[model samples]
Target: MSGYCGASALNRFVNDLLFFRNRLPLHVAEFSSYGGDNFDEAVQYLELWIRYSLSCPVAKLSVTSHDKYQRWLLPKGLITSEHLTALQLTRVKTQDDLDFSSCVSLKHLKMTDCGIYCDRIMSPSLKRLMIAQCHFIGYARTQIYASNLILLLLVDCMGMTPLLVSMPYLVEAFIRLGYCNDFCKHSYEIGDCGDESCWGCQFYEDNYGNNNCILLHGLSSCTNLELTAATAPFIFRKDLTRCPVFSKLKTLLLNEWCITNNLGALICFLQHSPVLEKLIIQFEPPEIHERLVEIGGSYDLRKQSLVLKDLNVEVRCDDGDERVHKVLDVLGSYGLSPEKFKIQRPPKLTRARFDDTWTSGSFSFEQEI
Candidate 1:
C-alpha cells in the first residue's frame, strides 16, 4: 500500500478480492499509489481495485496518487455510483464527459491537486463540495450546476474561473480566484479591448454583452460569502454591472479587487445587498498604486442607501496610512459613521510595508474591534 508491489503480489491481492465470496458491506475504501516502473500495469491494478470497491458499494471512497507527472483517469463507474456518500480524490484526472448527475446518493465531494478536463459538473444530491488547488485543463470555461449544494469552497484553483449555475440552497461559499484565471490579466476597465483575435477579450465581450452572471448569480442565495481575487480579476468587476441582489446575504467579505475600480464595485454591492449586516474588507496596499479602471461610469454613492450593523477593514498598513484614510473616506461618503466600523491590523506585523506578494491571514472578523 505504501509503495509499488511486485506484479505477482498485485495479482494475488486482486485475485483474493475478486474470488472472496463474503464481501462485507464496505463502509470506506482508500487507495494510495506512489507509482512504479510499469504505468499501464499500475493503471490496470488500480482499475481492478476501484471496480471491486464499487461492487462492494462503498459509502466513502478516497484515492490519492503521488505521481505528479501522470494521473489516473477516473473510472466511469465511480461517477455513477449510488452508494458513495463521501468521495475524496487527489492528483486524479477527470475526462471531459465527467458528470455527477448520476450520483443520486452522493453528498460530500472534495478534490485537491487534481486535473479537471471537464466542461461541466452537474449534481443534484451534492451538499458540500470543495475543489482546491485543482488544474482546470481546458480552453472553455467550466460550468458547475449543483442546485442543492450548501457549502462550497473553490479556492486557489488554476484555470479559467468556472461559471456557477444557480445554487438556491447554498448557505456559505468561499471563492478565491487566483492570478492564473483566464481574464485576470486582461483589462476590461476601458470597456473590452477591441481585439478580435484575442480570446480573452472576445470571451469578455460575449459574456458582458449577453449579461451573463458568471459567478454572482449562483452565489446569490448564500447567507455568508467570501470572494477574494488576486490583483485584478475582471469577473467580479464585470458581474457588478449586472449584479444580483444578495437577499439572503448577511456577512460578506471581499479583497482589493472590489475597490480596484474607484470603489465602483464596492458601492454596487452595497446598493444591491439590502439585508447585508456585516462587511469585511481585506485591504491590499499595492492596489493603491495601480491605475484605477473606469467601470459603468462613476459611482454616485448619495443615490444608494446602506445600513450595516458592522464593518471591519483589515489592512496591512498603519492606522494613519493614506490607504486606510482613503477607504474611510469612501465609506464616509456612503453615510457610514466611524463607530460602525473599525480598522484592524495584525499585532506582530503592524506598520510593516506590504507588497503584492504579502498574503493576509484567514478572512475573519474575530479580531478585536
Candidate 2:
C-alpha cells in the first residue's frame, strides 16, 4: 500500500476484500513483501469494516478483515478457528496475522513469508494450501482429510522435514529450491549437498532438503506441476514407477540453467513422454551462453513417443549469442531424428516470451535456436 498507501486506496479498498469459510483473504496474491512493514494495520481496518457491512448484507456474505493480526484475535485468540473460509496470508511477518484456530470454514489457504505452526488439524473443508518462505516450529502436525483438496504449494520451506503426504486428492503441487524470501530463486542452504545423497529432496521432496526414493514415488494426486530444480535430482527413476499424467505432461519446462540433470535423466526425459507436445529448455551457461542448439535440435523425440507432429522443442538463447550447429547434430546422431525438427528461433525476448501459455501451447519454428 505504500505506493498507494494513502486514504484514497482505503476508501475503495474496503470493498475489495472477500472472505469464505470461517477464514478471510488477507494478502490477495503477493507471496512476499517489498517495502511495507505495517500493511497489517491496513488489513486490520478492512476486517472490522467487513464485519459492519455484514448486517446489511442479504444474499452474499461479503465479510472483511483489515489484515490486523492481534486486533482481530480475541480473548480466545482463535479467529480462523470458525466461520472462516478462504485465507490469503501472504508476506505477513506476524504469527497471528491469520487466526488459524478460528478459521473453521477454511477451504483455500495461501501463505508466505511468516512463521506458521498448527498444533491441531484444521477445517475438513480446507482443500488448497499454498505456503512458502515460512517456518513452522514445534513440528506442527495437523491431520486433515480434504477429499475436495486441490493444490498444495510450499516453496523455500527450508524448515519442513519431508513427510509422507497422504493428500490423494491434491491436483496441483509446485515446489522449488531457493532463498525463501525471493520465491523464484534459491541459493544453497546446502547448495552443493548433491554429492550423491541429496538428489530429489530439493525439487521433489515435500520439504526443502534432498528427497528420498519413497517421496519421489508419492506424487499424491498432483497432475499439474511447475518445478524448478536447483540441482539434479535422482530419487526416483521412470522405470521404478509410471506417472501417466506427468509422463505425458500437457505442458513441461526444464530450467537446467544453474544445474543440469545427469545424462541418464536427460535421456530419460527425452523418452519419458509419449504425449509431451511442448518442451522449453532454458540453457543458462555460467560464463558463456553455451548455445545447445545441437543437443535440443537433434533429439530422439520419437523414442520418447513424441512424434514429429507432436513435438515442439524451444532451446532458449541469451541475446547476442551466435548460431548453434552441433547441438542439432547430436539429436540426429541418436534415435531422436531431426525429421521436421527446426531450430525454433523464438521472436526477440519480449513479454510474450515470458508467457507459459503460448510457449507451452504451440509447436512452431518461428525463429532459430
Candidate 3:
C-alpha cells in the first residue's frame, strides 16, 4: 500500500471487522504504526474510525507510534467513552486538564514514555495504573483520585510534581522515584523542566525528594510495598512529622541501597508495620556501595519495639560486615532465631540422591503465635 491509499485501507479494514453494517458493539482496537511515511496520518484515521464506531464502544485500546518524536495526543472522545475497560498508550502526549469523568468502564491504564500534562486523573472505576518513564508536567502536584485503584507502579518517571493519590483500595505498589544516573540531565533534556540548580538540589527538595510525603500518605493503605533505592530515601528522613501507620502492610522489599545505608529507615518500617510477615532484602552488585557510610540516616532506634508476627527474612549473600549484622541483629532482637534467616547466594547444586561426600546440618526457628 502507498501514501493516501494506505490510510484508507486501514479504515476499510476496521470498517469490515468492527463497524460493519452500522452495528456498534464493544471490541478491542489495537493500532500500531508500521514505520511508514504516513505514520501520523494513520493514527489520525484510526481515531476517526474510533469516533465513528462509538455505538460499538471499545473495551480495550492500545495505540503506539514507530517514531519516538511523533507523539499522538489521546483524543478526548476516547477518554470519555463509557465502554473503555483498558487503555494503553506509548510515545503519546496528553492534553492538559484532560477530563476522564465519563470513563465508566476503564479498569486498567498504562502509559510508557508519554507526556502527561493533565492536572488530575479522577477515575472511580480504574483498578490498576502504571506509568513508566513518563513526564508529568507544569504542576506542583498532580492529583490522582482513583478511589478504586488496587495496584500502582511508577518506575523512573521524571518531571512529576508531588502526587496526591486517593487510592483507598490500593493493595500493592512499586515505586522507583528517580533515574538510576543523572536524572535531571536526562529529564531536562526531553521535558524542558530541569535547570542548572538541579545538581545542587537536596534529595528531599527535588522532584523525587522528601516532598513525597503526600505520596506516601496516599499509599498508607497498601498491604505490600516495594521501594527501589531512589524511592527509599523519601522514607529515610528523621524529620517525618509522624510515620504514617501502614495498618495493612505485610510484605516489604527494599533494594541494597536502602539496606546498606539506611538502617534507621528499615527500623522505622519494623516499628510501624505491626503485622509485617515477609521482608526481602535485594542486593546490588559489589561495586555499588563501597564508599557509602554506615547507617547515617537520623532515626530513633529507641522508638523501635517489635509487634511483628512470624516475620521471615531473606538476605542476599554479600561480603559486607556492618549491613549484614545490622539486619540480623534487628531480627534477632525481634525474637527471630538465626535459623529463620537464609542467605541467598549463587546457585549451588544439592544432590539428595548422590550426596555421599558432602554433609549439611539443618536448623529451624519455632515461634508460637
Candidate 4:
C-alpha cells in the first residue's frame, strides 16, 4: 500500500508483518512517500519495511522521496543484505558510519541527488553504477574498486575530490563533469594570473598530475566513450605522462570543446586506440571556443601512426578557414582520404558551423567550388 498510515496503525502493521515476513515470497519491495501527516510514523514504517526486506531473499529495493522537503537517511544495515542485487535511492543521504563493502550481490546502483559520505566502495559483483546530480559530503577522495563493472555514468556531480577507480572489464562510460561554484577560487587563480606569456595555471597543473592518471587507467577497456565539454579540460590542461591503451574502444564521441581546447588529448586517444573506427565531434558554444584559443595548448601529443578509420568533425565557423583545413590535413597525414573529407556548409547563414564525414573507402576527394 502506497497510502498514509497512522502511527499506531503502522506499528500494528509492522508487528503483524513480522509474524509472516519470513514465510512470504517477497521478491521486490518499493516504498514511496505518497501522502502522510505524521512524518515520524511514516519514517518508522519505511524503516521497518527496509529492515524486513534486508532480512529476506529480496533482490530489489527502491525508495524515493518525491517531496522536496522530504529527505531520507539510508539505514546503515541496508548494505549488509547479502541478497540485494539492485538498489535505487532518490534524495537519500548517507552518514559516516555507512559501509557498502558488504553488498557483495549488488549489481546495479542508481543514486540521484544523494550525498555520499563514505570514502570507499568495494563491490566485487557490481556491474552498472549511475549517479546524477549527487555530491560528495566530506573532503576525502572517493575510491571505487569494482573488477566486473561494465557501465559507469557520472553526470553533473559536484564536490568530487580526486577519484580512484580500478575496473578491468568496463565497456561503456559517459563522464560529464561541469564546473561547480566550489572550484571558483582555483578558476580565478588560473584565469587571472596565468594569461598570455604565462607558463600555465599552477592549480590546473596540480589537478592534472593527480586526477586523470588513475581515472583514465580505469576507463582503458571501454568500447564506446563519450566525454562532454565539462570533463574535456582535465585532459586539455596537461601533457599526460603515462597514457592508457584503449585496446577495445571502437566508437568515441568528443565535444568540439575538446578539439578546440585540448587537441593534445585527442591526439593521445588516437595514438593509444589501435582499432578506433568512428569519431564524432560536436560544435560547442562560441565563448568556450574563444577561451581555448586564448590558453588552450602549449604542448601537443607526440606523433605516432594510428589505425583510425572514420572521422566526423563538426565546426562552428563563418566559412572554411585555414585553421579548419589544417586540422583536416593533420588527419589526412594519419591516412584518411582528403577527397572523401567533404565539409557541408549550411544552406542559410544560421550558425558559424559545418559538418564533415570521412569514410575510409576508395572515394574521390571532392573540393569546394
- For TM-score, candidate 1 versus 3, the one ahead is 1
Write down the TM-score of every candidate. Answer: 0.83, 0.50, 0.74, 0.72
Overall local distance difference test of candidate 1:
0.70
Model 3 weakest lDDT span, ten residues long:
359-368
RMSD of each: 5.7, 9.5, 9.6, 8.4
Indicate which candidate wins on lDDT. Answer: 1
Clashes of each: 0, 46, 4, 3
What would the TM-score be for candidate 1 when compared with the true structure? 0.83
Which whole-number lDDT from 0 to 100 does residue 75 have in model 1?
70
Candidate 1 stretches greater than 4 Å from native = 3-22, 184-186, 205-211, 284-321, 346-369
Task: Arrange candidates, best TM-score first.
Answer: 1, 3, 4, 2
At residue 177, what lDDT does model 3 achieve? 61
lDDT of 2: 0.40
The number of the candidate with the highest TM-score is: 1
TM-score of 4: 0.72
Model 1, range 82-111, lDDT digits (tens) per residue? 888888888888876557777789898888
Deviation (Å) of 229 in candidate 1: 1.2
> What's the best-to-worst order under lDDT?
1, 3, 4, 2
Query: Residue-wise lDDT of candidate 3 within 196-224, one digit each (tens)?
Result: 45541233244322334546677778888
Tens-digit lDDT track of model 4 for 1-369: 454354556456666866765657668877664445655555656676777777776888888654566567777666667788888887777765444567788888888887776766567888887777777743445666677988877667666443546677997776666653223223322133444433323333433323345357777888877665464354322323356778888777665544543355566667877777666554434454533432423334555656445654433343544446655766776677765455544223232111122121201111221
What lDDT score belongs to each candidate, Candidate 1 first?
Answer: 0.70, 0.40, 0.61, 0.59
